[model samples]
Target: MTVSVAALIVASPALAQEVQPVPAPEPSQVPLIRMAPAEDEQVEEPQDQGEDGEPASTELPPEPVVAIPQEWAPVPTTPEGRSAYGYYLAGRSALASGDTQQGAVLLQQANRLTPEQPRLREQAFTAAILAGDLKFAAGIVPDAPGVSPTITEAGQLIRGIETYLADGARKANRLLAERPVEMPHDRAATYAQVWIAAEAGDWNRALAAPPADFDPISTLVARSNRARLLEIRRRYEEAENEWKELTAHAVAGSLFRLGYGEFLERRRRGEEALALYTAAIQAGQAEPRIYLAQQRVMNKQRPPATLRYREGVAMSLRTAADQMVAQNANEFAAVYLRLSQQISPNAQTQAYIGQTLINGNLPGAGRAVLAEIPPSEGPLYANARAQRGMSFDKSGMNEEALAEFKLAAEAAPDDAPIVYALANMLIKMERFEEALEILNGPLLNTADQIYEVRFMRGAALEAVGRRAEAEAELNAALALQPNEPSALNYLGYLWVESGERVDEGIALIQRALAADPEDGHYLDSLGWGYFKSGKPEQALEPIEKAVAKEPANAEINDHLGDVYWALGRQKEAGFQWQRVLTLDVDDKRRAEVEAKLKDRLNQLPYDRVAPAVVPATQP
Candidate 1:
């Protein structure tokens, strides 16, 4: 998602005209059945080197490792059982390939054929939930008896939600209250109680103050819910006061501003509502609904009123979903998001679901969710396409990523984020000239002054051996944003590596470190700067710290080896150099590392001098 600075300079004004609205793919056309390669099976491309010789792409954080079951028991061998087993395998394969819809269908078939098979039933349930087929998931609850506690709880939650959606609040509350012990610490369940009360027209109880023990988010949600209910009841003054109090917090999100704006619009305060809408948009809240309302207001059209009851329910679910995401309860979050979507189907809700899936590392599922947003929803469509590009990039489908970015850029030619994303991808692909052309041509006359574009330009300049221009661009970037860590780090490392302005380099690096104290790359640069300044001993601690923080980083490892050799720890240096060979270093760096491995201390570029011997007789 990191775009090159130069590439981001392009004025994509023509891009929107070039992009046409595209329809979502049919379920049958969606290529969800493609299986991702296993980690061992994946062939890692050599990381591109940046201007400072670091990896061009930011390294993705390691995914949490989960233990897979070591064995699978053989399926039944009877003719009917065998047939079911085949279907089950196909279903699992489909799921692995990201085709949740097909997977669910196939798994459902398998479950029906082998009604007694717990594994088949469980898988079918999982697939259905992942596909957002809650109805199907609800139907299979009966078949999941005596399964794992997690599965049982999931079934209960699904059934509970279905009952709530189908029956009235009374029936749903009765059903949910039966399993209070199961959700002892469940924030969602607690919020649901408030929502049910509000649904049943008990405004006083619904607005009742939460307990002291309630979490900050829960407390905020409670207040917001009460305000929303007040607005619904046309208590304008009370609602206005509540909204002002809620939005006064610096941490208040777009949702609060949106609610307040709606309230203002409803009360015939056009200008005030428009100001709030503009502020929300300026604050980078890109939800389609907000943009539509803003446009409507600008044109003196009436902003549409959403049903207050549905809004209340959606808001509660959204708050719970946010909590679930914070807890890393991805499935639970998905369920809440899906429920919200069912009630509102707003662009904000859809975007939240897609983003949540992406954050959870379910890019395939995330792309599916994003695709559901229609192109007619301009803001959401552009945002979704950009996100889809990111998903492709994360999945290692670079070409597809490029295409998606291009599509998004065309759709919103003036959108800096999309243009920057496209350019960044090009930089990652090492198409430096193309990236530079975009920056210099389309972006030359553009008025937006983004520091990221300058920094990326500097990187591209360095990549193409235009060091002076790169240095100038970097300086320009620093001038624009003095404390930008990437620029400070890059420029500092460049000077340090070239054995120029050692003290200034060290100072810049220190500034960067002050900004981001735990950045392993910055630490390595500081250590390297020390070594370059003929203070190998001073380099030792920082280098070791950097190595400790990023043990697998090839550059850090190599730098450590150099520091060790300078300190006369030849054997330790050798081990570190050998370790570099096992890492994913670029070809040029690998060659240099290999040379160092062969020659050890002799291959190092440091100016090592023996200590002078003084005659004792002089004293």
Candidate 2:
């Protein structure tokens, strides 16, 4: 059901002049079919039946999903079974057209009605697989008593993909071992095994021979997966050679192009990678897969296209004008944004452009671009606003950021991440009560959003000084995701701040550090934990690392100054406090640093301060 770029182009020529809408199918045509009658039920054959009273073989094959020269032959209404088959066709049509949610809903309804029909069940399994709901696919696949071996095997393949993605390598290996040595032409299954083996770190198995009659597409996938596995194992030479073999036959619209190009670029073969990425971009358009590939190319220095000026106006500049106010971009990301915009204008591109700007610390510009999109864009609009809010928060404009987060939450009430993000923003603004209300009212009320809601709710409660309630909520979160880093960091930081459970807090921070070694916040928390445990010297290294990673972080700098002072490095501590003042920190924190500096300087016994050494270059 995935629409390839080539297939889209082929379909495009016939769809020119105007975009026409198809008539809605009748309600009775929905995929719902009641289960067939029990086998013992008496039945009567019609006079038109063959000599043995069996249905005639005169019926033609169903129409292809694509448009064709001939009109579809009318199906007989008298046969309920045929009517159910037509519904399955309609469901596939909906799926192929990119209405996957609707298609799956319809297909589910169809399966319920025709539970005994093999073809209907097979169609359902295919629909589920394409939707990436492997668990659902597996459940239905095995229970489909009358389904064909082809479809069941296909479902097995989908399950393998799920296993690989979910990191269930041992189970995946077992499943692969059970397959026949002479595997059938089930490419989906073959690719699933390849993905499983590769992800499981089984490079040898991945590089082995593929099943019989492997299609060209599956061959490329298997080879690509094997190559990627090699790269992971640092067998770069072998991986590069495999990539070379795979690229020659890689599908024009496949996602593998991104992975392949990334590998080539990693190996320092920039020219080859750029060529592959360029080919990928030219091979597809509508799906935006090509645009992503092109964006990657532009990020790596070769512009996706040359910036051209016409009639005294730079086209790229004009595009930027239309888009930038809504989003911000760092140097590298900005390049990707401009190039992607040049090639295609889409919601995702716009969103990414906005995100790039925000992450680059341009809140005002990011908000401007985000605001240009109408609310009718729904989730995309909300996502854009969330990025803008994050930019605002990062730049210390907490009030404005909170407003944007609130709006985003309202716009996407069903999105757990959006709601959780708004909660965090509210907590940052010290509007903990408001955050709690949001979590309790809508986020917690929604069954699908419970875990995230509870986590954020705990954070909000902690911010509001409800320590007991916060601990309880955090405990609940631990039940859901035992080693969740956010919960660990938040609870551990809280304990460190309270000067209680210092050892336990340090242990928790260590656990979080193991999960995300480079996280500045967790590093800061660990440093503070050590400081509280009366180990100032031990705290210095992590605090310095934290400040280095997050150069503009006010709290970390303050903490570093505290640690230096505790260690009796008076001159160095004084310098850190002065540095904290020079940064654009909040007024309250700046006042505290200024007061500390004044108190420290007054207590110094030295007649005069040492002359500061100047650096040759300044940031």
lDDT by residue for model 1 (1-619), tens? 0011111112232322332211112222211112323435533323346999896765564333232223335543445555665676787787777677787788788777766655456667777777778888888863332343345555666676677678877666667667641431245555555666667666665666765666554565667766766776778798899889876754444546767777788789989988988887887754567788888888988766745565656666676776566555555677667777776678878987888777766677778888888878886788998999999998899998988888888888788778888889999888999888767656442556578888988999999999899999999999999999999999999889889798899999999999999999999999999999999999999989999999999999999999998999998997888788788789999789778865755543222335579868965
**Cα lDDT for residue 413, candidate 1:** 79
Report lDDT (Cα) of residue 320, candidate 2: 27
Can you write out model 2's per-residue Cα lDDT over 148-266, one digit (the tens) per residue? 34344445544554454455666776676676312221433443444455546665665676554543434444565556556666788888787666545323324355556667666
Computed on alpha carbons, the lDDT of every model, listed in order, comes to 0.71, 0.60
After superposition, candidate 2 runs with Cα above 4 Å error: 1-417, 445-451, 584-595, 603-619
Error of 1 at 547 (Å): 3.6
Give the TM-score (vs. native) of candidate 1: 0.67
Instruction: Give the CA lDDT, 0 to 100, for residue 241 in model 1.
Output: 91
Give residue 551's error in model 1 in angstroms.
Answer: 3.4
Task: Estimate the lDDT of model 1.
Answer: 0.71
lDDT value, candidate 2, whole model: 0.60
